[model samples]
Target: MFDWRWDFVAEIMPRLLWATGNTLMAAGIGYVIALVLGLFLALGQRGSNRVLTTILREGIEFIRSTPLILQIFFVFYVGPQFGLVLSPWVAGMIAIGLHYSCYLSEVYRGGIESVPRGQWEAATALNMTRWQTYKQVIIPQSLPFALAGMGNYLVGIFKDTPMLSVIGVYELVHTANAIGSENYRFLEPYTLVGFIFLAISLPTAALVRLFEGRVRSKMGMN
Candidate 1:
């Protein structure tokens, strides 16, 4: 339906490449934060304190219910009003990271729940503290179970990085849009963005599967 232009692609390649770096940074950094925070969130829901458990469970549900874009806006815009101002990059990272962490929390909870009740009973019989039981027994087993879900979300977060553009974080989609607006060639910019995402996503997803196998094998889960 529209014309394609190699010259325009050539003109925008460098900018797209630079913006790809920003996209990776957002995905990588945000994923790391989500990994750590999600663990705590999952653990908090399992705590013996009923009040704390209820609060955490409800909070995670609320986060999972809302759209991530609103969170990004809240963190970037409303945050300043509450003395929590941050740069676009930082705000987008935190917002998306926190959004995904709630999802990962559910994944972790499922993995944790999959562990045998006998394991918990044995830990109780041995008089291990809950923290010690989780650290020494539950976590090691659960991690392998959780790996596949984690891998899925790893790809998901990378794909979702485009949402950061709404907050003006110069990720791939934002850069492509800028380029299109400048050159009046949406085809080249958008097509390039799709290819770039596909290129990165396919390899990353494969690697995640490979790593999952390695982890499961290493943990004697396979």
Candidate 2:
């Protein structure tokens, strides 16, 4: 029987906890970038110019079509070849933000489209400019729809943070790998890593569900 090393676990616990802070920071920054950039992409898609709309649509489609891992590799490695020298954290956040922005842009598009056409017509009849109409009428009503989708991506980002380890971001999973390698005790480190993920994700998932319910209720959909 393989004996458990309690001493090793105790020693690694602090390191794992410390690394989790980095993970959370990365996730937080990545989410912020995704949110801001996503709104822009969505607005671009819905802009007045046909060329901008086409470009936005194609750009989003290309991002959604590609695997995120390759995107990370490309941004971290290939980008430097072209004179873009991004740190691992910056590259990871940018990659994640860009990839997820494509998805959230679709969410924003759906939200904007879901607003009643009559609202637009009413604003136009009132001599409201297009920007004014969108700002004062369309966006407020569509916010709830966007919120639900945004919440989903927040959860998605949390789950995908492990991928950042590949770029040398030193998140929780990366720390776990280091501990396991040093001690050659794969079982404890991997198992603890899974538990850590579950502890963080399950609660976050519940919050998303609660927020989704609130949004639906507020939108009169529930």
Clashes of each: 0, 0
Model 1 gets an lDDT of 0.93
Model 2: pairs clashing at backbone N, Cα or C within 3 Å: none
Summed over model 1, clashes come to: 0
Per-candidate Cα RMSD to the true structure, in Å, reads 1.6, 1.7
TM-score of decoy 2: 0.93
Model 2 has an lDDT value of: 0.87
Q: For candidate 1, report its TM-score.
A: 0.94
